[model samples]
Target: MGGAMKIVLIDSNARAVSSEDREVSVGSLTRLLGSKPAVTARLPNGDRLLTAKEPCVDNGFTIGRSRVVVGAGVVVGKRDAVGAYTPPKTNVDTLTKLVRWVAPDNMPRESEDGRTMVTAILVDPETRDIRQVSLRSDAGSLDGAVGGRCRFMMRVTTADAVFVKVGIGPRAAWRKDGLVFPGRSLIVGCSRYGTLVDVATDIASLRASVEFKSPDAPDWLPPSR
Candidate 1:
């Protein structure tokens, strides 16, 4: 990848510190955490699961020097990491809200009206999740953007596939008329976890960018390096 990729950090609010970096490769995430995420708990069914709730903060991702420590609730993987992490309950609800807003209320929508089309990032009242926005499929000659907007949920552990209940959602602001007195932007603002605040740059293809060598990466999409 060249100097074409960029990253942005957000706090608890919709405020953001965007990136000017040229390229953010698929093998982009490099952990700066204290250790690999490890948590052990037995399920009520007598099963077990490991938990990594830590968030990606600062160079927690090697995108650049700038990093924000949202929390370590997310798992920290190896150098070439690939796994899924579900959004917190809050984000789950937020996602539900965004999906519901669309007329039919599906998901994985595209941006037809204009800016709200591609979801660069999803923002809650405070903090933002990179993968939590609508994706524009046609923009980069990519897949994933199937509906009017792209939405991914289910929060699988990073594997070969970025799995979710993907579908198209309605771009709420448009209706054969001009702009809705209150125009919408890419950064969606929300109140809780499942909600979203649209950002200016939603790189949907990255959702498909998995570590090239990781067997966990989705086989259909291009591998991330």
Candidate 2:
């Protein structure tokens, strides 16, 4: 791979941080983590399951550099000339509260007609966990803009499969219109490649990049070297 590939670190939240590099390769992971070692664990049924723990992180390129961990996973072998990691799954939900007026009941609601979308970043909020990113917005107007037509526009992001679940609720009757109902909700699970799960949405295919870290890396691996 070229020098373009950089390392990525994904916190427990699943949000990803792409190391400032390009052309990340798969074989590099095995070298950094040392090959996977076979481990044995007894199951509750008195049976043993053999498993392999792949390395997902590596030391910094040189001494005194920041450590680098692949946000996603490493790209191992190629299938049909395409390098791919274990694809992450995405799940998300969107809720909309429709009100005839702007007040405590409605709270300055945007036009009921715009598209509602969402964007998210995966991050483990626990402080004990090394991964944490501050998501400023708790509850407020989404930054996205709506089209001239009154359609609502919503966007969200997440780590696993990016899934979009539209709002679902009862309808409301407006002045003269009689019964005006909310739009149908949508659940989209897109591959890294941009392919939506059920809906016919264009998504770029996901390419493999990183993997897990070696079990001993926490201790034996230098902080940045």
Candidate 3:
């Protein structure tokens, strides 16, 4: 299942290959992931279901959890409509500390279905300045790729090196225009090498160009267009 999430890559012949795990037909995977219902089903005991629900965030990753209690219905599998879900955790101390310090205070407050958004906060430990960097799902909606290709455009790079903690949350809603929600979660740490002197102020714009900050190796993003 994890392999399904690896970014697809092309070989010298331009043929797509799976880098991490089992290879799946790109077309099929795309259809399965793309057309998820606003609500989905989960199988319980003896193909009987006792609940129904939608996806939400725990920690900082997407998860399907129960919203309705039906007592009993049709059991499909052992996986509950509300299964055990947790954000993928990282062991980096710096990131852990920073996220602990900042996330609760700055998590996004909007809620909507089918929305995936990232909010970046850059802190200059040396300078102790905090800048709120946010990107809305609307700003970088994924679309239009051949053969189940997933894509989006956003600007997220800094001119100077900096340590950035990015947190992504899922918004839950019952209607097109309802109260904003805060439940789903996804978090990633980015360290930009060189000098990301202006990263904080330009995060949103950077994401708009699909450019993001990285600290470990050479920048792996496309040049500004």
Instruction: For each candidate in the order shown, give its overall lDDT on alpha carbons.
Output: 0.26, 0.23, 0.25
> Candidate 1 local accuracy as lDDT?
0.26
**Candidate 3 least-lDDT 10 residues:** 139-148
Name the TM-score of candidate 2.
0.17
Cα lDDT tens digits, model 2, 29-132, are: 43433444222222233322112254343211100111112122222111223433221121111001110111121111122442222332221111111121
Worst 10-residue lDDT window for candidate 2 reads: 94-103
Please tell me which model should have the higher lDDT, number 2 or number 3.
3
Q: RMSD, each candidate, Å?
A: 22.5, 25.0, 20.8
Please identify model 2 stretches exceeding 4 Å from their true place. 1-29, 33-73, 76-152, 155-225
Q: Which of candidates 2 and 3 is the stronger one according to TM-score?
A: 3
State the lDDT of candidate 1 residue by residue for 129-188, as single tens digits.
Answer: 224545542322113332223333222222111212222343222111121211121233
Order of models, best lDDT first:
1, 3, 2
What TM-score do all the candidates reach, one by one?
0.17, 0.17, 0.19
Which is the better candidate, 1 or 2, if ranked by TM-score?
1
